[model samples]
Target: MSRRTASRALIAVALSVSLAACGSDDGADSPDSSPSAAATEVTTDLSEKPEVPASDDPAPDELVIDDVVVGDGAEAVTGSTADVKYVGAFYESGEEFDSSWSGGADETIPVPLGAGRVIPGFEQGIEGMKVGGRRMITIPSDLGYGPEGSPPVIPGDATLVFVMDLVEVTP
Candidate 1:
């Protein structure tokens, strides 16, 4: 199977295990237990910078992309340039490392997809997203800065999390 397909399979298995662990044996009435529900519950407001919460579950070995809000605008593809506002943090600790919104909510940066400008996980995760959409991207270390890491802000072999808001897509 292709890498993407394999990665997706791994994600599904990991999420299934995680959900099973969160379930109660007595089957008591519980809150919405889906991964999307938990992720969406953190922040769904489009106007504000997304808030990425700390995860109790172990980091996945593959990429996980969860859309918090679906947009109704132009789509982003390999050749498209995406103007996005984002907040980046460590997956394990939810400690912020970088953000396009650091300057201001209106401050966004353009990312050239498939251009090798950004990390592999980030570029791949943002693909197929539409303008005005918000997504949570969980990236394994291999797809991020790797074993050496970016340093200062990112640690060695860190699993990164990014809450991204796609503002516009330039074809």
Candidate 2:
């Protein structure tokens, strides 16, 4: 299979696995909590993968969303399908686990919002993003892979960090 096709396949399997995993919800809607990574600066261009720096701070207990670049294009909502380029890493180690950029610079993966097609943290994190925007999301384990995790790539009860660039949002 081509790299883009392979990447899409991986996303499908990941979404399914995340849906089947069980964990308590820490309520991603809370706005009071701030993670250290939320203050990080986004140094990469919209066309390239972001370089996530290692953080020594303790893992956050709630979902944290920070905008690196705000876009004036379409807003992502529950029914919207967003095409984005993203990099996923372990929050503590900053070790990259996956990246759509790995498929190729021209590649973007489509994520169906509010359709239970992705982890809660990811769904919630991308909810309000607009096309051309960039965001850094810090996902607590409860909202990510949970206790079972994805294995190999992601450890059990692991916190995750994602840097995403919204390319488009379509209904």
Q: What TM-score would every model get versus the actual structure?
A: 0.78, 0.77
Which candidate wins on TM-score? 1
lDDT of each model, Cα atoms only?
0.84, 0.83
**How high is the lDDT of residue 57 in model 1?**
90
Question: On residues 1-171, what C-alpha lDDT tens digit does candidate 2 reach at each position?
Answer: 999999999999999889767443545453323334444556637865787777888888988888777778998889889999999989888889999989998789899998988899988899878898888889999999999999777889999999889999999
Q: Evaluated with lDDT, which candidate comes out highest?
A: 1
lDDT of 2 at 87: 90
Error (Å) of candidate 2 at residue 14 is 52
